[model samples]
Target: MTTIEQASGAEPRGGGVEHVDVLVVGAGVSGIDAAYHLRERFPERSFAVLDAQEDRGGTWWTHRYPGVRSDSDLFTYGYRFKPWTGPSIAAGEEILAYLDEVIAENGLAGYIRYQHRVTAARWSSGDHRWTVEVTRGDTGEQLRLTTDFLWMCQGYYNHARPYQPRWEGMDRFAGVVVHPQRWPVDLDYSGKRVVVIGSGSTASTLIPAIAEKAAHVTMLQRSPSYYFAPPTTHELAVTLRQLDIPEEWTHEILRRQYISQYHWLARMSFEAPDELHTFLIESMRPLLPEGFDVEKHFTPRYRPWQQRIAIVPDGDLFAAVREGRVSIVTDTIAEFTEKGIRVGSGEEIPADVVVTATGFNLSLLGDVAFTVDGEPVDFPQRVTWRGVMIAGVPNMAYMFGYFRHSWTLRVDLVSDLVCRLLETMQAKGAATVVPTLRPEDDGMQLRPWSDPENFNAGYVLRSQHILFKQGDREPWTHMLEHEQEREILPNADLDDGSLVYR
Candidate 1:
C-alpha cells in the first residue's frame, strides 16, 4: 500500500546516495518471496529488488539450455501464497510465467529494478546502515544506495562461469564443445551426433529434448546418479480439479502432501538407504529396455538422496533410450580426440557436438565484496545463525533453502521468521541487530557450511572453504529439515543470548 517514496525516511542527497528501509538482492523466486513478506508485514518500509540479470526469474532467466525444467514438483516449488493450476512438473518458461503472475498480482513489478547489480556491501555500525555499490548493466554507470537492512536472495551458483574441466586433448577436438550453462541459441545440433557429458539433471533433460533433432544422442558419465520418474500430473490434483475444488485449495492440499512425502523419502534415505535404493532402481526397470544393464547405468555408488535425485517426468529420458534415440555410456573420459571423446577403455565415441553438462561453480554471496565497518568479511571463520543470518553481521539475512524439500518451502519459512524479527526490532526501538557468541558458546566445535556426510554435491564440496561455518548446538547450526524448521523458526526466542540489539 506504500510507495517507495513514502516508505523511505531520507531524501536523496545531491543524487549521490538514495535511502530505503530494506534492499533485497536478486529478483528470483526467493527475492520475490522476500519482497512480498516485507511489504505485507511492514507496508511502510521502503525496499527495492535488484538483479544483475537483464530481466527477472534469476536462474530461470539465466539458464536457456534445451528442455530446462524444474526437477522438483511445482506444487511445492511455487509460492505458498499462490495457486498453481498447471501440472506438477513445469518447464522453464512455465515457471517464469508463474513468477510473472505473482509479480503482477501483488504489484511487485514497481519495486523490482532489473540490470542493477550490487557489487559491494559495506556495513557501518556508526551510522547503523549499509552503503551498497551497484553497477548498471544497461548503462555503464555506478550507483550508491543506503539501507537499514539487507536481504540476500542471490542463488548459490555462479551464473556466468560454469565448471568445465579440461580433458587431455580438448583443444584438438574438431566438434563444438559447449557447456549447458552457456548454451548458444544459434548453435544448431540438428542431424548431428551429440554426446552429453555428465549424468545430472541437465544431461538427462538435454538428451531427451535434443534426441529427436540430433542424429544420435549419447550420455557419457563418470558415474551414475539416481533418477526418479514421477508422473507429470499428480492423481490427487487431477481428482481435486474434477471435483470442482478451488485451485487455491488444490494447491495447499498438494503442497502439504508433497512435503510429507519428501520428509518420508529423506527419512528412508537415512534409516533404510539400501531398501530405498532398491525401490528407486526397481522403479526404473519397467521403463527401460528389458536387456538394458540397469545395474551398470542406472545404479549409483552413493546412496539415494545423498545427492539430488533427478526427476524425469513420465520417464521421458528412459523412453528416449528405449526407443533407440539415445544411449548411455558409463566410463571416465580418457581424452578428446579430433572427432569426439575417447573413454578410458580406449573406445572412441564420435560426435559433432559435445555438450559438457558438467555443472557449475559455487559463488559466495554472488561474489560481492562485503565488509563490516571497513573490515572484510571472512565467511569461513564466521558461524551462521540458523542458516539465515551470519553471526556478527548486522541486520542481514540470506536465503539458503532446503536440499531435501522444495526450495521455496524454506523461503516462505525464512520470510516469516525475518518479518517477525523486524517486528521485534520495531517494538524494541532498535537501530541495529547482530548475532554474537555468548560466553557459554565460546568453545563449541565449528563445522563446515554443509556436512559432506549429509549432502556432498560436487559444487558444495568445492566451495566449503569459502562458505560460512556451522556450530554443534542449536541457533548456530543450519541445514535442518523442513519439518523441523517449520516448528522451530516461528517460536524461536528473539531475546535469546545469540542476538545483540542496539
Candidate 2:
C-alpha cells in the first residue's frame, strides 16, 4: 500500500493525522467538482478529496453490473468543464474514463486520498473547524483530520446496499441468483432462460442488453413504471454545428432542450395524468405483444414522477420485446422454486438465472455520525436551512438535486453557489459560515420535499423535499435554463437570511 503524504511534512504515526483548509468527501462527480471549484476560488487554501474506494469514479468504478448505462444522456451528464467524446450515450466504462480524463486534465489526482472512509465529523464552535475521523481501508487504521469546511459529494445512491426481495426457497433454487450490482463476470447466461426482477432503469437497460445473448429473458414487475424513449443525443449539437452558431448559443439551445423535456414531463406528472397515460400507451402500443393489455403491462398505478421515470433510447427495451427476444411478466414473485420462480398468478416460469434489480436502501448524510463539540447531531430532528445546507452546521453543504430533473443540473448549481459562498467568506475574513432560514420561511411548505411512496431509498427522502422546496423559492431555485444558473448562483447573496460569520 503506497501512501502519499501531503507537503505538511509531519512525521507519520500509526494513526496518521493531517489538517487542511477544506475536506471534500466522496471523490465522485460531486466531490471532484467541489474540490476543483474550491481550488479555483481559494488557490492559497489547501483542500483534499477523500473517498472510501481505492479508485476514483465512486459508482462508476464500484458498480460492476451488466449493461450499466446512465439514465441521463451523456450531453447533460458530463461536466460543464469537460465535454464527453462518445457517440451514443456512453456506457459505464466510458463515463468512468471521462471522469478520469477530467481528473487528469485538471491535475486533481494529487489532492485526492483514496481508501479513506470518513466515519464521523464534529463541528467545533470554539475553533470553527470540523474534526473528521476516518478508517484507512488498507491497514484498518483509524485516522483523524481537520478542515475549515466539509463538503459531501457522496451521492444519495452510492452508500446503501442493493436491496433484494426475499423469496421463499431462494436458497433452494439450483440456478444462480444475482443482484445486478454483484453480477458474476464468468456466469454464462447463453442458451439459458433468465428472469430479471424490477422495472427501474437498471432492469430495463439490462433486459435488452442481455436478451441479445440469452436464450430467453423475462422482465418480472410487481407494478409497471412509466418508461420514456428519448433520443440518444440532443439534435441541437447537429443544428448548432451546421448553422455555425456561436458555442455559447449552441450551449443555450441544448440547455433549452434539457429544460423543456424536464418541465414537460414534470407538468404531465403533476397536472395532466390522463393525457400522460394516453401518450405513454400510444408510444408503447407498437412494441407490445398483439394481445397484451397495454394497461396491464405499461400503465402504473402511481402518479407520473411518483418515482423516477426510466429512460430508454429509441425504445430499445420495447424493440427487444417486439423481437421475441425478451418477455414481460407482470406479476409479483411469490417464491422461488428449484427450477425457477413462481408468480402470484400460480404460474411458475422456468429460469436458469435470476437477476434481482430490486432497488436500494436509502441513507442520508453519508451515514456519517455528526457531532457539535462532542454532542451528537440528530439530522431528522433539525430542519433544513436551504435544502442544501443544514442549520447550525458551519461551512458544510450537501450535493442535492431534483428528482424530476437530471441530477447534474442541480449539482452544478449547488457547486457554483458553494464556490461563490467560499469567495464571499474569504472577502469577509470569515472563519466559519452557516445558513439559517427564517422560522416562517414559506419555502418549507412548498411541496412534498421528499417522496414517501417511492421506496428506492437512501438520500432521496431528505434531498427530495429539500430540492422541491428550493425549486419554489429564489436563489435556492435557479431557472432550469442553464444560462440562468450560470448567472444566479455566481452572484447570489451569501448573507441572504443569516449566514453567520465567525
Candidate 3:
C-alpha cells in the first residue's frame, strides 16, 4: 500500500479520499487476476481491490445452495496462472480453497479490502482522477477513495437479488418456498418432498445432491435445457500426474485441451448445428433410463451453444432419474397448491419444499452508478471497445466474460490489455484515454451487448436493455471468440483512432 497523495483542490488527511494508481472493484477471480498482473507488470504502482462481501470468491462465496458446483470444468474455469489440482468439476468449497491458496501464496491479501461496497463513481477529467463512494458493510460507515484508473471486475449479476418468478398462488401454499440464491443455511430437507423449478445448471446440480436425502425431488420446468455429463476427472490430467509432469505443464496442457474442445463445439454449433445437436442428444441417450423421453426432458428448442449447456458429473442426474429418486415434469405452473404445485396438465405434485433455481438478475458494472465529467453514463447508448472499455468512459474497464468458454480466459486477456493501456498512457504522458467514435464510425449500426441469435440465455435476454451496445466495426465490437482474441488482443494497436488520449 502507498501513502495517499492529495490531489489539487481536494480534501486532505482524515476527511480526504485515499488515492491509488488503480482501484479494482471486486476481489473475485477477475480482480485477483488484475492485482497479480498489476504487481508483476507494474511493481511501482499502487493498487487495491475492493469487494462488498465479507470474504473473497464473489459468486462462489455468494451462492450457498446445496450441490452448488461449477457448471464448467475447473481446468478452464480456474485462472490460467494457477494450476487446479482438484477434479474438473469442482464444488464451491474446493474453489474457495483454491482462491485462498492463490491469495495467500501471492501475498495479495493485503491489497484486498473486503466489506467495501462501491456505491458510485464520478470521473473528473480536470482532476485526472475518479472519486468513488464506498459503503463499509462491517461498520456501515461511509468512505471515499480516488484512483487514476477504475477496474470493474465485480461480476455480471446482482448477488443479492436473483430472478424469481411470481406465481398466482405462491402466497397460498402452505409449505416453505425458497430461492436458491437466498437458500436457508439451516433449512432441513431430509425426508421431505422437494420441488425444484427450472432445468438450468442450478436445478440439475441441486436435484441429485438432495434427491438421496429428500424423500422425493421433482424438477419442474416449462422448457428443457441441454446437459453434458463428462467424467469429473480428465484422463490427461491423470496421465500427466502419473508421469511426474510439472503442475504448470499439466495446467497449461489441460487448459489448451479444454479451449480447443470448446472451440470445436462452438464452430459445430454455428456451421453444422443439426449434426452437432444430434451428437449432443445421442450422447445423453446411453446415460438415461431405457425409453426415457429425451426429447421431452433434455431437448432444447434452440441449437447447441445457444445457451450454456449444464455439465452433469458422471451423469448423476440421470442416475437419480433412473433410480426413481428424481422425477422430471415439463409443464407450466398452473398455481401453487397447499401441498405442492399444480401443472398445466391438471396434475398436482406433492411437495413440502420448493426451490426456485430459475436464474439470476444481470447487473451492469456491479450496479455502481457511474458519471463522466458530471454527466451520467447511459451504458445502453454507449458502445464497447473490444468488449473491455465502454466508449466515452475514460480510464475504466469492465470484465464481461465469455458465454461459450471459460470466463477467466477473457479476464486474463482484458487484464493484459488494460495493463498495456496504462503503459501507453505513461509512455505518452497522457492523463486520460477514452474510446471515442471516429469520423468513419458515425453511421455504424449498434447491436445488443450479445447477439441473441448466437447466445440467448434467458437471463441475458431479460436484461439486454441494461447492457452496453456493440458496434459493427473492428475494435468497436465485443468479439466472443477466444482463439481469435488470443491472436488479436496481444497485438491490438493502441495508436488506433478508436481510442483518444489526453
Highest lDDT scorer: 1
Preferred candidate (TM-score higher): 2 or 3: 3
Q: Per-residue lDDT for 154 in model 2?
A: 82
Count steric clashes of candidate 3: 0
- Model 3 lDDT vs. the true structure? 0.89
**Which parts of model 2 have CA positions greater than 4 angstroms off?**
1-4, 7-16, 158-160, 235-252, 437-492
Name the best candidate (by TM-score): 1
Error of 3 at 239 (Å): 1.6
Say which prediction, candidate 1 or candidate 2, comes out ahead on TM-score.
Answer: 1
Q: lDDT per residue, candidate 1, 1-502, as tens digits?
A: 1112322334564455788889999999999999889878888778888899988998899999999999899999999899999999999999999999999988888888888888999999999999888888777578788899999999787998889899899999998999988999998999999999999888988889999899999999999999999999999999999999999999999999999989999899999999999999999999999899999998888888878899999999999999999999999999999999999989999999999999999999999999999999998899999989999999999987887789999999999999988998899999999999989898999999899889988888888989999999989999888889999998898898899999
TM-score of 1: 0.98
How many steric clashes does model 1 contain? 0
Give TM per candidate: 0.98, 0.88, 0.97
lDDT of 2 by residue, 405-436 (tens): 66677777788887777778888998988765
Q: Distance from true position, residue 152, model 1, in Å? A: 0.5
Taking every candidate in turn, the Cα RMSD to the unseen true structure, in Å, is: 2.3, 4.0, 2.6
